[model samples]
Target: MSLLDLSWRNMKRNIRLYTIYFISMLVGVIIYFTFAGLMFNEDVVTAIQNKENYKTIIFVASMIVFLFIVFFILYANSFFMKQRKKEFGMYILYGMKERQVASMVFYETLFLSAISVTSGIFIGGLLSKFFGKILMNLMHYKDDISFAFPLEAVVSTILLFALLIGIITFQSYWNVRRMQIVELFHAKEKMDKPLQFSMPLAILSVLLIASSYYTITMGGTSNLWKDYFKESLLATTVALIVGTYLFFRQFSGWILQRMSRSKNYLLGNKMLWISSLRFSIRGNTVNFTFNSLISAVIIFGVGFIAVDYAVKADVVRKEYPNDMIFSSQDNRTQQQIEQILNDSHPILAHETITGIQTEKIANRKPFLDHPDYYTEEFTIFPEAQLNAIVDLRGVGEKVDVKGDEAIVLTRGIDQPKTYLSTLPTMTVFGDHTFQVVERIRFPLLSIPTDASGGSEHQPSVLVISDEAFEQLKGTRPITSYEVYKIEDPKTSNNVSRQIYDIVKRTEGSYYSAFIDMYSIDIESSSLILFSVAFFAAIALFALASVIYFKQLREATEEREHYAILRKMGVHDNVMKQIIWKQLLFVFLPPLLLGLLHSWFLLYYTVILIIKDLPALTTIIFSVMGLYVLTYMIFYVSSTSIYFKIINEKNTR
Candidate 1:
């Protein structure tokens, strides 16, 4: 028979074994094809505001997906090749040339790739409309998306996967050509030496990881990070990578060794799996460490996206309480804005806030420690007017100012400690020294000015008693904000645009419209969330498949040991218990450590910026629960397949 016929028969015989590999490839193809289709979809391109940016983001995301698929396919191919080494060896022993065997392997891979790509593209085309609708909904686009199988996307996907298949076929051909017959026959029997614990390395691993965490969390305040930020960041990343590797390579083995020596080591089938794990630790260490790090990345990425999407509206509203805000010294300009808003939408509330701006404050000593905390200009508001504005917005709590006391609001500062107690007293106009009663992190108004617009400078805000404010009103440059809350602010884009044009043309005047800023934020965040969700899905799938494949390979190697235990009168329940323990050992460590790492990362980074900690915590836990559920599904599948392999009658 020709090599092609033999290769076809081999594939048919081993179809069951190829099921996971084929599914993984199919999923990769579907993701790539779907993303490509969206990139070329006319509806999506036209509906989104920034067409170039949208296309660029999708293109970059698709490239990343393609790279990941390449890695996954290559890894899967290597596993299959390793599993079939003995078969290749037998083919050589039966007088078949090595070239023939290699050709056969190539043909098998080619056939599998063709089938996977064809089926995957067909499914991807069918799912494109559903995914498009999801993207549109996330982006808050009202237009209906019509499905079209873009010829460009189809041709591009075909060409890319075809190149991938060619590369895979060449790799299989090369791997078969280079393998010695003896090496192939002995490949299944080859195992790493038993793990040896090293005290020095274990200690180093702990120190490395601990120091890296400290650097990431606390280093921002340190001079090293402040002065050499890039270097510090790079060092932290390197330390984390090396530390994680050492953690699995040495620290984990040390712990296992200690556990094996414990008094209860031989209890309840512990000896069965514990002994096996100790021997296999050397082989599994790298995989465990890699999966752990990837898990952390996946969690951190998804957690940030979830929190960002959840809190976007709240953040926008907090920053801009008034649906439309503009400052104008010209009464005619103000009248024009009022006319524009009144004609376009129903007005919910309208209020005016008068404030004074100062270039300097007499009590600058409090800000000496962090000069950036002090702005060149300060916007001072009277307690009554500020309280009225807050009450009108119906979002924030109303503040009360007592005699000679002021409440300070720092623009864009999220951390409470950064603003609270840092400013105890303020002397405005170089004469009136007021006691600082409380400090708020966000600004009261959203308009950009010398007090709020400069880079790296926070706008200083003070709300004093009404009597105190009247005393200094004539001494400083006065500014007034015409704030308006209109009906359906989020949907009033056209009205916002009209007002924006008028405000931009007026001298020394600016405006903040809720729809303008909120739409950009919501759309960008929605796109990020959509992309990240899929990336996380792909990572989880890959991680699970890697573990599944490794477990299956190990099961094949340990089948004889299991068969011997069965003959020695081990019960079915007892054998299953052993398998469960072994698989749990493989799956649990990475998950727990990854969770811990991600939790710390988010706490130090993402959590600080978020206003709603309780909501963010809920989102994080939900993500964790979902991640755990996915792993559990894979764990159960691996265990069942492993049990079947071990209990098979013909394991030769």
Candidate 2:
């Protein structure tokens, strides 16, 4: 058989052991393909036709994620290469030249990588349409988008993977070239105990971990992400990674010694469990470090991902009841404008009158917390604009302050003259003394995320009752809200004409109409693009962690332990239970903590977007489910490898 056929046969012969590596690499390719396609999808391009920044974010995020996947595929392929050392040695012993062996390895990898990557990308594209629809639906976008299997995206992702595979293949070739017959012939020799790390390293690790986590939770909210940001994270991560590995390196002895002395908590299977864990920790310090890093990466990556989604999905729309909204200035009378608007669209809701509130917000340092809160200069609403707004949104319902008393509600403000002033300022008009009430929630289109991703703000009408409307006389004339609700939403195309008519009839100026679909498209796309990038980083860390541990387990000693345990009459069921327990120790804590972290991040991000918390908590469950489904697939594949080791032990 040709080298291709021989290598293919060898790969199939050990398919069980190689499947995890293959599947992970394939999934990475798929994710990259899907994201690349989505980023440049025709619909997205058409919708954001002239928006350069949006495309830039899409490309930058895609490139970062794609490069990450490349490194991951290469890193992951290393372990598979290590595992095949014995087969390579035998190929050499059977008089196969190293050059031919290199050719064989390259062909097999190229064939396997191509198959997996192509299949993965194909599946990813097939499903991306559904994903796009669901996302658009969530934002209540009525626009129909076309999602073609983006050939360019597929080609780009494939070329990247192919290049990565070539690098890994070359690395294998170098390994074969360097291997002497002795090392290859004795590939199954036992491993020796590794030198322990110094005591200071453990303490350092503890300090590093505590410090890094503190920085993440505290610093992640910063908007100055362009500056000292990346450096700080890099320094912290390096400290954390080195320290953790060192701590785990010597951790086994310390743990075992303590547990052996404990009279209560150390007594039964607990000690054994601790012993096993400590053994794993000591023997697999690198693995433990890998796991911990993965967990932290998951927390950080998902935190950012969820937060980005929440910002666009829930926070940004908090104050805008529609695509565009502004309260009018109080001095102007908007009665004629409201009437004109009412006369035009029979189905449009009337202009809502809201009680304007005024407050002299003190200090104001914390109000606009983020540096990007607002621009330096913007116009405050004039009295005429306020009156026009009142005409549009005024609750003509009068408050009977009491007999012979009238109170006027006014838009109140004491806005500071800085770029940071976020809350609006209002001026009370007329002779009415309007007392300040607590700052109320602003209006925004509150489309809940339904199965189809509906994006529409709710209509709420709240104003002072008739008893509260009268206290003192005001100069501003009462402008009754005039709105018409039509049964069909689609027929509201003429609402702009109605507004213009109102403007002409009332001689009204500064009227605005809320537009749809475009805004929703922008917001949702920005969020999903961020989400895919953040999640890709997390997935990389998780895959690295799982595979690292598996590599550690495959090192000669751990497999021998399985052999010894079987020979000692341990029940197969007990052995299975132990493996199960081991898997949980590795998997559960991070998963739980990562999920809790996701909820917290989601909560904060949502506040940034919509200025309200999600009423339903099921999203937490959904996020958790998604994580488990994806991460656990790799975990399960790794554990099944243990069973194969146990079988090898028994046969011996």
lDDT of 1 at 637: 96
lDDT of 1 by residue, 1-652 (tens): 8899898888788876777668877887899999998889898887776677788888998999899989988989888888899999999899998778878877877777788888888888778878889998887777677877788898999899989988887888889889998999999887778868898999898898899898878736679889999998899888888888898889888988888899999888888888898888888888889998999999999998988888888777766556877776378877777787788787889888888887676555453344456665678899888878777777666777778888767544443333345447776677777877666654666644221122234446678899888887875678887888897786776777777777778675756766666777777788789889888988998898899999999998888888899898998899999999889989998898888789888888877756555787889898888998998899999999999898876444
Q: What lDDT would each prediction earn against the true structure?
A: 0.80, 0.53
Tell me the tens digit of each residue's lDDT in model 2 across 1-652: 7887798788788775567677767777777777777766877565442346556666776777777776666666666666677778888889999889989988877877888888988887866676656545544445566656788888888888878777877887898999887786666574544343445655665676566555555545566434668887687667666656655565434544465558875443465455566545544555556655565456445545554554453333333233223234333435544444456444344434333332333322332332133222212212232344434434222122232222212111212122223323222333333322222333211222221223432322123334434331133344322223333322233454444444444433223333233344445554564456456444645454555446444534366776676678766777666666666666654455445434444444443444444533444455456666766775675566666665764565
Candidate 1: the clashing residue pairs are none
Q: Tell me, what's the RMSD of every candidate?
A: 5.5, 8.9
Which 10 residues in a row give candidate 2 its minimum summed lDDT?
405-414
**Where in model 2 is the C-alpha error above 4 Å?**
43-54, 143-147, 186-253, 260-283, 300-308, 311-346, 351-530, 533-545, 548-557, 588-636, 648-652
What TM-score against the true fold does each predicted structure earn? 0.80, 0.66
